[model samples]
Structure formats: structure tokens, C-alpha cells
Target: MIKNKISRGVLLGILSISVDGIAGLAIFPVLLYYQPKELAGLWILLTSFSALLNLAQAGLGPVITRMATEIKIDSTDSDIEKYYLKVNYCYRIVVFLVFCICALLYLFYIRDVLIKSNYLSSGIIVWAIMTLGYCLKIYATKNINTVNGYGELGWDKLIQIVVTVFSNIAYVIGLYFGLSLIFLATIFFIFSLVYLYGSKVILRIFVKMPKILSRKKINFSEVLDIFKQSLKVLILNLVSVIVLNVDILIVERFWGLNVIPLYSALVKIVTLIIAVSLLIQQMIYPYISLSWNTGVYKKARDLYLKGLMISLITSIVLSALLFLTAPILIPIWIGYGNYLGAKVFGPLLLFGIVYTHFHSHVSPILATGKKTYITPAITNGILSIILGLLGAKYFGINGIALGNIIASLIPTIYVVISTLRFFKTHSKYGGLANGEYKR
Candidate 1:
């Protein structure tokens, strides 16, 4: 069963992400052919908006994954089942409300800024709709994946591929027809709906029978506890996003919106590599959650090490490829003549990618244990902002990239040391066999 899960999960992940990359890559050609400047501006706007939307997600997807795994392990407990459903529903309600409110506030309050910035007027509205669609899709999909990570992934990948293919085709058609950004945004929103519907259908197939709602109704105290738990995870996600994304935002403001497309293009290429790493990380999360729940600490630890090694090796190879190809690829891909020497940024950003990959793997492990506050509060939150600001002011885009490298290093190193120390102490105390973790 374990082997089956791993094989299917990895394959589906690779398949889904490959389609995602192709779809993403297709946009570059569209941008190059139609509107290069707007393309750059759109890149910055989309990336920034994506970061904000992710912040709004507040890591609930992983929380759902954890809860679902727990319920599956203790499936015999009717009370546990009831409580899980109640929490799940409550989370959905709260997240939906919060996302809507935040989206509205941004739309109304920041109208002037967005307009003056020349971002598509309807972009935020489209984004809000898409965000809701994404939340629903994620909630359903996370639970399905947690219950049976491998089995459901095939369907998930197929849905994604379909969406990607259609979306790109729509973009090309829209561009050919001289459609506005608002129209393009609408097309994207419709694509999200398709994904949401597909995910809902898949979810229905896997949900257990005799579904129970909590006998103890969700109350103020329970809401507060969930919010409190979510806040820690939210902060962690926010800081991580800011550390990873703020450079582009800063560069957009300071350097020019035009620089963003070039940088975003480079970042996207690197993200393709990271996405594969993330797939492995995502596959590992449920295993870690289940192993921890069952008191299989050694198994969890071994899994962590294996994921780390894979991430490191993969990141190294991908980074090397980017470093070698950036000079030639950037000009050919985007036709930005001024970006000739952008390859210099490749190696540094690769460091950020490796750190990011490591951080991604460790974060879920911490979150599964519900220990979310430590990394963000201690390492990422304040320090990253200060370093990023200082670096951008002094050194430009490369400086900003360097700032990320530095900021991420501290947290990544700390987590590694702490994890290793934990295993070492456990081994010394005869907590593991041959001082080695179980598979």
C-alpha cells in the first residue's frame, strides 16, 4: 500500500506540475507577441496578488490534511468523526467570510492605487472569485488527498491538465481577438470554476459514509482556538511569502514595472524545479502527519531525511541548469534586450530555491505537530522585512535576491540543526534502532 501510494502520488504530481509548467510557459509567448510592457506589468501584478491570496488561504489546506489523516486513523470513533466535520465546516465558513471581506476591502479601499497603477480594473474582482473557487477546490482536494493521496491524484492531474490546456487556448484566442485584460481575467475565472467543479466531484467519491457533524456545536471558544492555531500558521505562510516574493514587489516599486516580467519569467523557470520538490514535499506531509499521529516518530524522521536529500539534489541540478542557460534563455524567451546579464542572478536565486525547498519540507512537519510559531516569530517575520528593505535600497534586484538568500538561511539552518539534535538525543536515549530512524 505504501509503495503504491508513493508511486502514484509522485507520478500524478509530476504529471500535474508538468502541465502547469507548460500552461505557464505558453503565457510567455502570448505576452511576447502581443503586449510586452503590459505583460511585465501583469507579471508583477499577478505575482503580488498571488502572494496575497495565498496569505488569505492561511494554511488551512494543510490543517485540513492533518485533520483528515487523524480522522482516518481513528475512523472507529464516531465522536471524533463528528468533531472533525464540525471543525471542517466551521473552517470553511470562517475562511470564506474572511476571504470575501478582505477581497472587498482591497477592491474598494485600494481602488485608486490599482487604477493609477494601471492594473486591470476587473482583475481584483476576478481574483476574488477565483480565490473563492480555489479555497473550495483546495478544501475538497486536500481532504481527498489526505484520505488517499495516490488514488485521487490521477483525477486531480487530469483536471489540472484540462484546465491548463483550455486556459492557454483561451488566452491565445483572447489575444488574437484583442480582448481586454478584464476579458482575460474572466476567462481565467471560468477556468477556475471548471477546476472547482471537478474537485468537488472527486471529493464526493472518497468521503466516508455516515458523515457526522459535531455533537458539540462549534462555539466562540472553539472558533477562537482554531483562529489562534491558524494565526501561527498564517504568520508562517505570510513571512515565507514575503521573503520569497517581496523582492519583486520592491523591485516593481523601485526599479520599474518593466523589470518584473523578466524577473518573474526567471522565477517561474526556477519555480518549475521547486514545484517538483514541492510535490515530493506534499507527498511526504500526509505520511509525516499519519506517522506522528501513530507515534511512529522514527518513520517520520526517516521520511524527512529522504525528502531533504531529494530536494537538495534536485535543486542543485535545476539551479545549475538555470545558471548555464539564463543568459541565452532570457533574451530568447522574453526578448528583453536589456536583460542580457540576468544570468548573474541565477546562482544566487538558486540558493534561495534550495533554502525554500528545505523550508517547504520542514514547515509541514512542524505544522502537523501544530508547532507553527517558532520559525516565523524567531527567524522569518521581522528579520526578513528589515533585510529585504535594506538590501533593495542598497543593492537593487540582485541585492533583494541576496537578502532572501540570507534571511532564509537562518531559519533553514535552525530547523536542520534542531531536527538533527532531536534525532541525536533520541538515539542516545535508545529511542531508535541502531541510532537510525525507521522507514
Candidate 2:
């Protein structure tokens, strides 16, 4: 039954991820053919920047999900309601802070995007609209995550598929009509609203909530403790943003806005491939967290290892196919002028492979709720930036890709080694009997 549940989740996840990835891929050709290349780059940067702005979420969503999952295992209704109260209170505060930060950043730095804007008013309006939408969406994150925590993965991914398909259809139609970028951002804004409502509906279906959940007073001390537990994950998130998303900013700085379309496309392709490859791990994440927390150490270890094997295999095969086909596909899909050749593509390919391995290894450690990977993550982010800056100054785009490969490779090795060592120690002691952890 558990296996069936996970399989169904993976199927649903594949559907949602495929639609989003297809939409992501389709946008490049649509933009390049109908819009200026620089504008395409700017839009990529805009989305990246918007994602970075979500650093305000402070890594609390997963923490809350894990908390709710563990609580629901044995806790009473009132206890669950109290947990919900605390989580919602904390999210409200965080969401408000996100809004303020977004407003201030737009006032000070984000508005400067107009310097690159083909449509000045639309750029500002779209960005502001996106920011507001993002702020509104953050609070819903906990509820969406809680649905997953309850093991309603189909429902969780169903909401994702609905929102993604709805928004992408609007995006494609607007692009076909040669609509302005404002239309794209508006689609995203509307998607957020839909996502919020959908998450709430799905969550309520799984967990029966009391009517008074909204009216309960919050305890700031409990919120503070949640923040304390979240600090390491918050650090991990910061590093993740740097390693995964900051490259475009670096590329734009060194290579100029005109080259961003191709570079961002390469990154997006690698990202989509990685996302597909990690479906097994994603499906098993809640189980890993629950098993590890409940002291089923051997089960958690086996599940993690199996998921890692499948993820690595999927990533390897898909990446090889992508690498082989990219040369032929690039020119045909987006035109010869936009293709960057094998130099840029090769290094990023290796980077993607190493990064995939890193995630496969790192996810189990995170699911265990241990801060084991924080130092490695921090090292990765710092090393990647330093190497990227030097590589950009001396060797150009290939250098940046090489930098990513090396930076990602190092931390991946550390994580694997650490995880193996820990497993070896526990296995010698007969696994779960000695490995039960406090929730």
C-alpha cells in the first residue's frame, strides 16, 4: 500500500513537473522569436530575482511540515490545532516581513530594471504585481506542505498540476498573441491566488481543523523556538539560492544582457532534467523524514539508498541524452545565433550531473533533520562564487561552468562520505535499536 501510494505520487509529480518544464522550454523559442533577446534575458533575471526574494520564507515550510507530520502521528486534535496556530502565526509574520522587504527592495534596487526595460511602465507594474503575489503565496506554503505531510501526495501534486497548467496555458496564449511581459507576470499573479485557495481546500480535506484555529492567540516564544530549529535549513536555503540561481546574475554582469537568453536556457534545461531525475526522492521525502524521526533507521537508510540509486541512474541517462542531442537541437529550436556551442554546454552538463548527485545525497540527510550538510553547503556557495568570479574574469563562460562543476563536486563528496560514515557506525550497532531519534 505504501509503495502504491508513493508510485501514484511519483506519477502525479511527473505530470506536474513535465508541464512546468515544457512551459519553461517553450518560453525560450516564443520569447526569442517574438521578443528582443535582451528582453528575454531581463525576464529570466526578473523571475530569478523574484525567486531569490523568497529567502524571506526562512526555510520554515519544511520545518512546519515535518512538525505537523510528527505531531499527527500520535498527538490529539487540540495539539494539532495548536501546532497549526503556531505555524500560521509564524507564517503571517514572515509573510508580512517578505512584503516589506519586497517593497523596500523595489524602491531601492528593483526599480532599476527599467534601465533595461523595453516597456518601462509594464516592467515596473509587472514586478510589483509579481512581488505582491509572491508575498500572498508564502503563507499558503505551510498548508501545501502539510498536505504532503499527511501523505496526500496526489492531492498536493494535483494542486500543483492545476495551477501550473492553468498559468502555462495563459502564458502560451498570451505569447502567441504577442502580449507584453506584463501579461506573463499577471498570469503568475493569478496563479498564486489560485494556489493559495487550492492548498487550503486540499489541506482541509486531509486534516480536520477546528473552526477556532483562526481566532487563537499566538505564542511568540513557540514561534521563536520554531525559528531556532529552522536556522540551519534557512542557511541551507541561502546557499542553495547562491549555487543554483546566482549564476545568471554573474553571467549577466560579465557577458552582458544580450547573451543571457542562451545561458539561462542552458541552466533551465539542466534544472528541468534534474527536477525529473529527483522525482523518486521527492516522493519518498516525507517517508524518510517520518521513518528517521520514528527511529526506523534501517528502513530510512534502505529507502534513501534505493532512491539515490534510481535518481542517479535517471539523471545519468537523461543527461547523456541531452548532451548528445543539444548540439543538433539548439540550432533547430532557437536558431543558430542563440546557440553557445559545446564549451559552455559541456561544463554546465557536468555541473548538472554533480549537482544532481549532491541533491540525491543531501535530501536524506535533510530528511533526518540533522544539520550535517550546512557547512558543506556554505562551503559550496562561497567556493562557487569565488571560482565563478575568477573564471568569468579570465576564461569567460566555460570557466564559470567549470567553477560550478568543481564547487558542486566537492560538497557532494563530503556529503556522501559523511552519510556513509554515519551509516556504517549505526549499522554496526544494529540500526534502529540504537538509532531512535527525538522528534
Candidate 3:
């Protein structure tokens, strides 16, 4: 039954992300209506801040999913209860600490930017509240993925759709009533609280609060090991943020901030394609982790190939559609008067989409064990910075997209070749029989 549920869960994930994309699309109207010149600055700040928050997440998402899969396979309900409790507690604490540190940093370092931009001071306060609420939401959402339960995913998606609707309603109200940015931020925080409360309700159905709270002492050594193991992924994650968002930042520095809304609009469309790739990756991760944990390397290899095929087909079709229709669709969506076609940016984005699909889908395969993590992290970081800078100089907006494509391409090639070579060498030596091979 659980095996049958994975397909449904994957579909739910796609729908969930699509809801988020719709919300993103809806926000463009507000950006275009008010303060178009400052749109890029806002995007830069939002992305940079969000990236910092994610850094604190520290790759625990996959770890939690792996742990959950292992618990489910063991089929010991009691063990599952204990494991969930310990993990959830640790996850919450980390999230809270991360929010606090980030809020403090923003208060001290980035306050002037906020003030000068005419954003209300209350916006900062609301951001802190939203961050705390999201921490809870993230933990609850991960539990659904770990247990292969799509009910929570479906529920989350429904709530997101509602939130998006409410946000748009609030945007209209703000514009009609002349509300300040602080009020908009407050509305956002209120919506976050609604989602967090919903998450708690869903979480209670599968796990009691007491059971989800850690009673066993969490050792610093164990935490450190987790941090160490996840550090490479964390670094890889940071590099990814830079590669993806740094273009807007560079553009802001060189060009005026007004160019950002145009750039942001283009990037958001590309990100929708990426969201689908990420959904496939998320679904594949638990399966890969389970297969690897059981030493079924062949099964893992087959799964990766299957994901790759799916990714290729979907990416090509979507990329082609976006490239061909961008001239018409973007203008209709954002109004032709305000939008400009970044023609070269579209093709470069196609490459980046393919590169991102492969990288996201294959990362878990490459990160299966401690020994394999370094290659991806190192290669992604080095290439991201080098190509990012070069792309900024050589191609401007398109160059940034090209740099991201190149950055993702290198590690993907390495992982694919290495995995296939390992499989081949193992098959030749009869190591395939036991699923044991020298890497």
C-alpha cells in the first residue's frame, strides 16, 4: 500500500509546488503596480535572506527522510515513535536558533536598506514571526514525506492555495486602501500562523505531541556528526543559492534596481520548470536512500536512470514550450508595456533547467554515503563561483544563466560517469552478486 502511495505522493508534491508558483505569479502584479524600480532590490533581499535561513536547515531534510524510511522498513511501530520524537525535537531547536540568529543579523546589518526602501519597520517584526512559524511547518511537512503519507502533502497544498488567494486579496485591499508595506508583512505573518496551526493538526493524527518530543538526551557528539556529514551538502546548498540568485545581485550592482522586476519575472518562469524537477527529486530521494541502505546498488542505479529519463522528457518539452511561447506568454502575464523579452536569457535558462534537473535528481545518489559527498560539493562550489563571475562579465543576464548551467553540468557529468563506471567494474568482477564493489 505504501509502495502504491509514492506515485500519488509525487503527484501531490508537484501540485503543491505549482501552488507556490501560482502565488509567485500573482505577486508580479503587485510588484509591477507599486515600486517597479525597487522590485529587484526586494528580490535580492528576499532571496539573500531566505538563502541564509536555508543554510541553517543544513540538509536535515534528506536525513530525516532517510531515517523515516528506515523506520518504516524495520516495521517496528515502537521504534518509529521514539525515532520521530528525537528527530522532531532536534529539528525544531535548530530551526528556532537559526531564525533568531538571522533576525538579529538583519536587525543590526540590514536595517538601513529596509528603511530606505520605504518598507515599514513592522515588516521586520512580521518576518521574524513568519520565520518561526515556517520552522514548525517545515518539520511537519518533512514527516509526511518520510512516512510516505500524501495526506499531509495534499492538505498543505490546499492551504497554500488558500494562502495565495488570501495574499492576493490582501494585496488588492492594500492597494485600494493605501496600506503600508508593514501591513502587507503583517498579513503575510498571519497567513504563516494559519499554515503552522494546520500543520500541527495534521501532525497530531500520525503522532502524539509527547511522542514527537524528545525524551532521550541528544548528545553534542551526535549533533556534530550530523552537522559534519551534512556540511558538504550545506556548502553545496549555499553555492547553489549564489549561482541561482547572484545574477540579480550583480545586475543590481551594475545596472539599476529597476531592471530587477524584468529579470525576476524571467527567472520566476524558469523556476516553475525547476519546481517540477525538484518534486521528482524529492520523491526519488527516499527510494534511493532505502535502496542504498539495503545495499541494492543495482536497484538504486535503475531508479536513477528512470528518474533521469523522466526528467529529460519533461524538461525538454517544458523548456521548448517556454522558449517558444515566452514572447507571447510573458507579455500577456506581466503586461507587454512593462515586460521585455530577454531572448538569449530564455535559451540559457533551458540549459540551466536541464542542468538543474539532473543535479537535483542525482544528488542523493552521489550523496549516499559519507565518502561520496565531497566530490559534488567541491565541484559545484568551484564551478559556481568561477562561472558566475565570468558569466556576469561576458553575458550579463544571459551569462549568469549560462554560468548556473555550467556549474550544475560539471558535477552531474562526474556523478553519472562515476556511477556507471563503478557499476561496470563491479559487474565484471562478480561483485554485483553481493552488491559490494570498491568505489
Q: Which candidate is the best by lDDT?
A: 2
Using lDDT as the measure, name the better of candidate 1 and candidate 3.
1
| Cα displacement (Å) at residue 61, model 1 | 2.4
Model 1 scores worst on lDDT over the 10 consecutive residues at: 430-439
lDDT of 3 by residue, 1-439 (tens): 4245457657776777777787777767665676445733463355445555666667666566566666655646556666665566667766776777667767775565567666656647645655654565455545554443222234455556676678668866775666655556567667766766665665566443344444667665766665666676676676667666666666665665667777777777776777676666656666666666666667566666677677667777777787888788778887776555555557556665656555654465543552353567567767767776788787666676677677777677776677666644533453243464222
Tens-place lDDT digits, model 2, residues 226-299? 98888887888788788887678788878777788888888888888788888888789888888867777777
Separately for all candidates shown, the number of backbone clashes (residues 3 or more apart, or on different chains) is 0, 0, 0
Candidate 2 off by > 4 Å: 116-120, 430-439
Per-prediction TM-score, please?
0.86, 0.94, 0.84
**Looking at model 3, how many pairs of residues clash?**
0
Output the worst ten-in-a-row residue range by lDDT, candidate 2: 430-439
> Per-residue lDDT for 278 in model 2?
84
lDDT of each: 0.63, 0.80, 0.62
